[model samples]
Target: MNNPEVYDIKAKLEAIHQDIKRLMEKSNQEYLDIMLANLKNDLINSLTSYVSDDIEHGLHRGMVDPCQMRETCKSRFTEFLENNTSLIGQENVSKNIIDEKRAELDEIRETAPFDKCDICFSEVNSLFEKQLNLISSRQIYSNTEKKQTEISSIPEELMVKSVLEPLSNKQRLQILKSMASETMTFTALSELTGLRGGNLLFHIQKLLESDLILQRHERGDYMITKKGYNLLLMLSNFLKFLEK
Candidate 1:
């Protein structure tokens, strides 16, 4: 038998290791979320603008030419779909991988002899669900008049509100600001913002859900999306307009 103090110390060390592992996992997740958000936004912006430009150019060339506009829209839409199919495919793959991992982790927790904590399992579940939702909600908007018509029917205020809702918090704003400069891992973002990994992940998930940010390149490091940059610009403009 070991001394009580020795066992206590060992227990403390094991707890510390577990905590570190959780932090690392959460940090990695944050980075991926940010990158995906960026990719989704960029794709949407690219497709939308490309389609819109083609329509406008076609109209200018032949104001009364319905056939020309139709041809232009069709071509642009085809290009957008082709380029983005690969991205959509990747998103599906990532979601599947994450879902599988979550299932495996759940099974491990269920079968392991060690006492599993409910709170830890719940957190893990929530994180995985959030990512999966983000993947599903991720969309690439096209500039075709039909698509634009759909977007236009939705109130602009509602669109702004949806995007701004996730970014309303001070901590989230700080994280976005840090991401605006360069892509950083979740651990890096947490350190910069002085936020713990779990807390940071919660806010990041909100942003991801709102399509204000994205997760990209899921292996070890992550990248931000162009939509995020456009968001930063929108925020800056809103602030400037308020000041003026």
Candidate 2:
């Protein structure tokens, strides 16, 4: 028969092991959370700046009225979208955004734009706020020669398999969205998604393999990686734009 004291000691060891595992998992998750936040902020800043430059350029191009003559501000915004977005291979995304912007151009044409610089800037600021929210992708090197080169350098087959395959399942998407704000253990996830045992694990494994999530250790809590968070953020932005 097994000794009672030996069983007590083994139980203590197991509990201690679990405690250490939790601490390590927490530390790792905190780091990932911070990185994801930074990435999100970076995307916002870049997109905001992209539009701001165009606004400034448009203002500069506005012809000063000679003898208080009225002249309509020919929109650089629409022309900017038509020229710039086509280069990025985001044909559908660009088209949708352009259509929304086009709706506003009719209203904008009513104003004698250069008359009040402040009002022009203020109105354009509102637009900047609305449109920037629609674009949250990694435009890190966007519209630059670097991005043009990077686009062709990427392997088409591998990239498609990696991004599209993992995102194909409803449960896999749920698992990712669930862990966006916090890390989750296997049991907790199974409970949240109503999945069980190996079935739950199979989905988790796909995310892990795709670098979309990180497991603290074997049979440990799962945390979303920066790639995972960024992808979801971009998808959310694009889908919201598409829905309108």
RMSD of 1: 27.4
Clashes within 3 Å, all models in order: 16, 0
TM-score of each: 0.34, 0.39
Model 1 agreement with the true structure over 155-184: per-residue lDDT tens digits:
777666666676778888887788776777
Where is model 2 more than 4 Å wrong at Cα?
Answer: 1-154
Instruction: Please give, for residues 92-159, the per-residue lDDT of candidate 2 as tens digits.
Output: 34435545655665555465444464455455545544444444243422244455688889998777
Best by lDDT: 2
The candidate 2 region of ten consecutive residues with least summed lDDT is 65-74
Candidate 1 least-lDDT 10 residues = 134-143
* Best candidate according to TM-score: 2
Deviation from native of the Cα of residue 68 in model 1, angstroms:
68
